[model samples]
Target chain A: MQYIHPKAIKVWRIHGMISAAISFVLFLVLMLLGLFLFRWLLYLAAGFLVIGLVDFLIFVSVIPILRWRFFRYRINETHVVIRDGIWFVKHTVIPMARIQFVEAEQGPLLRAYRLAKLKISTATSTHHIPALSIGQAQKLRDRLAAFIQASDVDV
Target chain B: MKRAHPLSIFAGFFKELKQLLLPIIIGALFGIRHDDGMSEWFALFGIGICLFFAVIEWWRTRYQVLEDQLYVKIGTIFMKERFIRFERIQSLHLSTNPFLKLFGLVRLEVHTAGGEDKAEFALPAVKRDEALRLQERIGGSNRSSQEDLLAVLDRSENSERVYRLRGGELVLAALTSSGARVIFLGLFTLLGQIGELWDRVSFITPLRREFHRVIGVPLLEAAAGVAAVLLIFWLLSSAIAFVKMYRFTLTVREKDWVIRRGFFEQTEQIVPFKRVQAVKIRENWLKQSFGYASVYLDVAGGQAGDGASEVLLYPLIRKERVAEFLAAIRSPFPWAVPTAAVSIRAFYWKIIKYVVPLAVLATILSLWVPYGAWSWLLVAASMALSWLGYRDASFAVDGDRVALGRREFSKETILTERKRLQFLSCRVSPVQKRLKLMTVQSGLIAGNNGYSFRICDLPLAEGRRLYEWYITAYTRSARRELQRVDGESSYSL
Candidate 1:
């Protein structure tokens, strides 16, 4: 099993931070509205703030754990496999021969780390594995292309 | 040879202008009646818009073929550049209205078996003789090109033959197919409107009141009345079949299948030999009684719309004639060959599998709501239906050909070559794992329709066998080409 790059945690953290900020602002507005509308409702606003904090903490903690748990990739002479989930694990195996195209994408956060996400698309569906070092992504792409050409030759 | 009428543009312009006329007239009326200058201005604006469109159409409407490709350049500001290669071209269609016929011209549409978005290239106003000459030249060149390619490839398979349907057969075929249902639906709507009008006019008011008072009928009597109404409906539907399918005909010419039908607006479609992906022979319970079967070609790039088959090769034919038709077309598959019937395990699995889901839903619904017993009845009906479907399902492998038969409301048997499969997958679900079974889905590259066939619940060994056959067939087909390029290892990049 190949571990997803640690830099993937940074991408997830960026996503989580955006979500947290939105929720935090909403919480602040609701609290202010409750204080103006009803004295008793301020207690409900406090409870909501506590729940938001807990959710933010969970989101912050889970990203790194998920990055550690997930493994994806292509093996020589075989399909590309992405194994994920802490429980009720999912393993998606897409044959290289079926791959129509390979796209390497870099979002803003991933660009900061110089990491790219490799997306493999078949005729029917697409799968993505994010935060790979540039060198690793290139090597994987070369191997995938080689496998695809070999299979096409055998077609 | 019929050229698309020079006046055809005016007809189109008039049609478009007529569509816009409603808003224009409404605005004009509003302006005149309400004495509003703004409405008058809006009406003038509409006229300006219509004239602008007419001018644009006049400029960009002309089409001419150059060399090996048909080019159709249309649109004004957002210009469309369409090219249809002569080799990729399947058929050139000529259609004309009475006005176009008067002008000795017809609309020419070139169809290719490719992307749905880019399949048709149309020439709206071509002379009839020129269009015919173009079709002949393209068709002739296409044949010779294939012959040359075959010689180079060293394959001497006989060229495909085209089939045509006779007028009587075409009518019969259309009548037996879903065309009958469409006619019935139309008539039913008409009758419903008449009935509503009759009720409004107080003509049937006294009769309805009398009938209601006389309706102290028993439960069984009411059930019998319902059955009688259903029987009358069925008779009405069959009557519609006779009227609509009055003059249907199908024809085969060389390597093309032609179907011409319609009571009012006649439609003709040609299906080329190469475009047919699979031939589906279907049967239904009623068809068995009538000694008739429906044949459909799974032709690429045709879409069924409303109630019409996009490409109607042969609407309805006797089962015995299927073999002769197949032989005439040089269809690669064996004609109506018997295949292995699905195991009784198929029946049991289908029933039990459906029952479990229904049972779960029934338990929940019964626990939380009324009419719980009815939910149990629903489960029973579903299980029965699934059992019937499973019993009707079967598949066969005859040499290089695979035939799959699936029966639901209608029975469909699809015949395809192993090499045509774009991809094959063997899936073992958790339930299938427990049962030592697997499902094998075979996909053909069918443009926008995507993967065509999904076969499920085969024994693991059988699924593996099918998968191996697919891989072997594909590899064998390409082996010679690969061997020729043996030393060129740099192709991987």
Candidate 2:
């Protein structure tokens, strides 16, 4: 099992805050439209606050649990297999040749924590594994790049 | 740097204002009747907002090329910077209207391979000479780049053998084909105008009373108006067809096919030969009578606003010339071949599929409406249509290519290559599973141009064989791998 960096909690918290802010604005608009009573509007705001708080709590509290549950990936001869998913276990295997591009994204919060999200894009879809240490993401990117380059030669 | 013509802003503003005026006026009238101040205020606010936008557009619209990329910077608040790479550009099209022609200006459109919404980067107005110069530079650069790629592919000689249709051939093709469809459309427009006028004069009692009261004329004067309206409509539709399709010509150049159509707003689409996924030559019963066929190309670009990624290459052409044209493109299908017609089972299946809906509609109409048996006529018509569809359904394999001929409102024949297939999937539904049947769908993703050719309902074994063939034949060398054993040393030995 591979552990996501503790810094991921900050990223989740920031995302939750942004979501809550947008929802609050929407709630205010609904209130202005006279769709809900004053008390109902207060309750709705409170509910959104609670959601935001819970989201932040989950980020901080659930990281260790997820880290214990997850697994890191390394490319094999043919495919890249990532085994992660808590209650419902999933093992995803993508062939190296199918990879279109690989990217490392870092938000301000993630950058502060020296963490990044590794993204793998294929012709059909994109997959992301967030909260990797900068060094780890770089190493993984290099490994995948080398593997793909080697596969190109064999083909 | 080429700036869009200053007058374009006014043109856009007026065009948008004209479109919104009817709705605004109607809403305002409704409001006036209801004595609603808010609706009046809304109308005023809408006009003000539109004027503001027009003003901003007039001031802020600008476009310029930066090195190998073209950028159009527009909007005031939510600033948008659209960048289009030169290499990604498929074609640079120029068009002009009478208004634009007065200024010696044209609209420039840069088309790329993707969704229709984002496929074109348009500059509404640019000086004709400058637009031409820019188009030439961009087109020349693209041609050189393509030539370089062709040289790498070792097919430079083949690229040199480009084919172009002469003016006489284009005119002949247009005359001998279902150009009569344009005539029929004109007639339809005439009928629509007559219907509108009849509704206005007969149904709108208040308008008629007001007109009579103001002019002190009898209702018979209004009845005379219908003749004038019909004549105007006839002239309008004919003029529209003439303007839209006048001087339509198709030309094939190295690694690209160009379709230059329209008179007032001329459009030239440069379609790369490699981007063509499927070639469909269709002949309806009407076309067959005149020995004409319509060619539709399933190119890897955007849809033709029809929710289908198929564009009509030559809407109407001679059946004999199809062979010559296709051969010029190195297209891999015989123009004329005896196709295997659909089985009787296919006809029965189609009947069963359509009959249920027809029967239900007939039952409801008969039970609840005065005209009951008349609904049965619809069912009969559907039965006949389904029979025709089944009879027309056919598929043929020509070398490494596959052709499917199907009929709906019109007959459609499609020919595609195995190498063009992007992905192949074999699907089994519960019903098909019971019958031991499978549906194979082969998709070619040459950008966002949707599926190239999809054939459904074949035997499972046949589907698997085709899927294997597609994988083995079409898989890029960079993606192919040797069989690897996880276990079983004896098998390896």
Candidate 3:
């Protein structure tokens, strides 16, 4: 069993920064409206600013580090086991023989971090491994693909 | 390779035209209202392209069976050849639309393993005899699954009919089914074309005035509206059921079980015995009281929209006759009878889970509005149902098979073989963990997606045992055979 790439923490923080940027823009617009249009709306602007700061401290800084510690996955000969989530935890085990395909994809954020997301699909469900180094993700995909090809079709 | 009947060229044309209908309709509408000269030409151009593709597609598409492989070559621009080995082929279905039937042609859809949202492909226009011959040739890949199939045929080679939904039973099944949804769909469609339908049914205007006069009270008006919807729903439900389930017959033969159903555009689905993943028996309160239940078979392959869903074994059958139906499909299952009342914790948890929240809401309503105290009756009803739910829900493991029975608004019983399970999962939320409870859930590939059987609020130890029971062999095998994932892979992700 292994935790995801530590770079995932940085990615989460980058994601949080983008969200903070959007909220800052919202704050500016709301404050302007409060000053010019509706005088009482300054209270809403103040509340939103406090929420954004608290969110950055607790969620952006603290939760990502906790998340990196909790998220773990292990792939074996017969099954893939995933133990994930800090809040709403889940443990999923998908049979190796039942997997239809293994795919690797990268979003702009993941691409910048040189990381990729692996999607392991069965006949019914798709399970995700959030972030892995690009080369490692491809290696896992190939190894899983070969394993799937060698295994009997149970689905 | 052989070409489809020439008439399919016309079918192809119409198929293309059907896809382009929205644009054509829009064009026609524009032509009629705005006197746009381009609108008529646009529709005509679209029709011309449709006709061209129809001819090209029909001409280029050819299919054949040779050396135990069903091969199809399609595409007009860049030819693509596809083949399915007889062993890999999952199910064989034959269908005929009225237009194709006019030329004595049937469409054969060959489904194989790997769930992609449809039958692997369809040979649009083959003869009925040809389709049957193709089905006969695909004897299925697995020999272990065939011995029982052979025995079934040996017992009754000449007699193919297992069960047929007779007219009365058909009507009863339809009546019991919730057809109100179909009528609601119809009402939305009618509302979509209100201007055209509203003008023709001018009688409704006078009837509305009469209703306004007689049921002047708001509550009575709502009551009348509901009664009318129910009346229309009953009529529409029966009609749809009659049309859909007309001459619905389940027949079996050597390799595959064939279900021939539908009044118009008749469909015949041939499912290989090995494809069956599990058996599900569902009984609502009314059906249970009547000693009747519906049996559904969960098959492994084919897309959901391809009408390859949980194939209905029997729409309605007497509970006593279930064993007879089961015997036809596969070996007789050990029907599990629950032993005792539900656990005290789960029974009480059901109170906290359902009744408590509902009771609080009811109390609020009772304190506020006029006659709102009636909400307490609903709270009482919810508590009763929850009790019934846990009391009836039980699971049993007998040898290599497991039978789970759960009762919600309906009683659902699922019987699954150990080998057929894709994966077994145990969900334990934080609250459930504190309560020392977990949910045991298992999945099997069926229809477009799959079917999952879940039983909740089991003791943590019990759930762990079940999870271990499912994966113990695999886990041991995994450790012995593979230690492939090693070292840096652990630290990387």
Candidate 3 lDDT over A1-155, as tens digits, reads 99999999999888877777677777788999999999888888887787778668766899879989998999877778888877666677877767778999999999999999999986667789999999999999998988777654344
Best TM-score among the predictions, by candidate number = 3
DockQ of each: 0.16, 0.04, 0.30
Report residue A92 deviation for candidate 3 (angstroms).
2.0
- lDDT for position A6 in model 2: 59
B2-46, model 3: which lDDT tens digit per residue?
A: 887677677777767767764554334322433567656866887
lDDT of 3 at A90: 69
- Give residue A153's error in model 3 in angstroms: 5.5
Q: List, in order, the clash count of every candidate structure.
A: 18, 0, 3
Poorest lDDT segment (10 consecutive residues) of candidate 1 chain A: A84-93
Show the lowest summed lDDT stretch of 10 residues, model 2 chain B. Answer: B484-493
Off by over 4 Å in 2: A1-155, B10-55, B64-71, B82-91, B112-120, B132-243, B283-291, B301-309, B318-321, B328-341, B407-409, B428-430, B433-438, B445-447, B456-493
**Which digits, one per residue and each the tens of the lDDT, describe model 2 over residues B1-493?**
4457777776666656878965664344322343455766776787788777876775676678778877877775676778877777755655566677788877666666553634355666777667766765575667633432222223234434433445665554544344335445544544465445434433344655666677666535444443344444445444554544567656556556656566545554555665676787877555766777878776654422222455657766677788786786656455545365344554555566787689898999899975465568668867876777666655555545766665655566767764344334455555444444444444443335344334444444554555555444323442452223112111000
Interface root-mean-square deviation of model 2 in angstroms is: 13.1
